[model samples]
Target: METFVCAGCGRIYLENSQRCGHCGGDLEERPASGRGIVYSFSSVHMGARGMPTPYLLALVELEEGGRILARLADNDEGEPSIGDKVVFSGLSDTGPVFRLF
Candidate 1:
């Protein structure tokens, strides 16, 4: 996924605002490695905005040093745990999607 980095403070952002919020520096766009660990997650039984029910939402702590909220890909086996390795699968209609590594 595309991420923005602050030239002055090295802060990373998923949204590109053309300027950094921290140090008023220029933002540079970069590709993420798509590798991260599951920091936290929840199973949503109530769907919204056309999303299906019983989906997993997670906060992934990226190896590149930032966190992203993404949906976990459908897995029939089971749910993921905290600190489990995950990789970016792709973008869904909702947002970025991740899967267990």
Candidate 2:
């Protein structure tokens, strides 16, 4: 995944920015490892337009540092849990999608 890092404060951001919103630091664009642990998640039975129902949404803590909210790929095995390892599967209409690593 693409992220912007604050050169001054060492903060990472999912969105690109010329400067850090936190400390007015210069932002550098870089690629992320796309590996992380599921920090938190929720099962959504009701989804938005064009989105299928009964899907998993999670807050993942990247190994490099920083968190991202992404959609969990549909798994035949079972649902994901907190601390479960996940890897970037691909992008979607909404945003990034992650699967069990």
Candidate 3:
């Protein structure tokens, strides 16, 4: 997986950003292990565009140290809880998606 590491403050982020939000410096692309745990999640009954109804969205706490929102592979995985193990599945045209590793 790929992420951006801030040259100014050494903050690693999963998104491709223009600059470091922390120190306003340049960013460099780097590889990450892409392991994470589900910190929090919710089901959206209504969605827009390509998103289907009653989908699961989770705020994953990346093992590399960043929190990102990604769609769950299983909407019917039952109620989500903190610390659910997950891995980076891939990227959607909309955003990232995750599944149990």
Give model 3's TM-score versus the native structure: 0.75
**1 versus 3: better lDDT goes to:** 1
Which ranking of candidates, highest lDDT first? 2, 1, 3
Cα deviation of 72 in candidate 2 (Å)? 0.5
> Which ranges of candidate 3 are over 4 A from the true structure?
8-24
How would you encode candidate 1's per-residue C-alpha lDDT over 1-101 as one tens digit per residue?
67888989887776789999889999999898889999999999997877669889999999888787889998866988999999988876787899997
Per-candidate TM equals: 0.75, 0.76, 0.75
Model 3, range 2-100, lDDT digits (tens) per residue? 989888887776687879988998999988788899999888998987766877889998887778878987744577678988889888875888887
Candidate 2 per-residue lDDT over residues 2-94, each given as its tens digit: 778899988777677698999999999888888899999999998888887888999988888888789999898798789999998887887
Model 3 gets an lDDT of: 0.83
- Model 2 has an lDDT value of 0.87
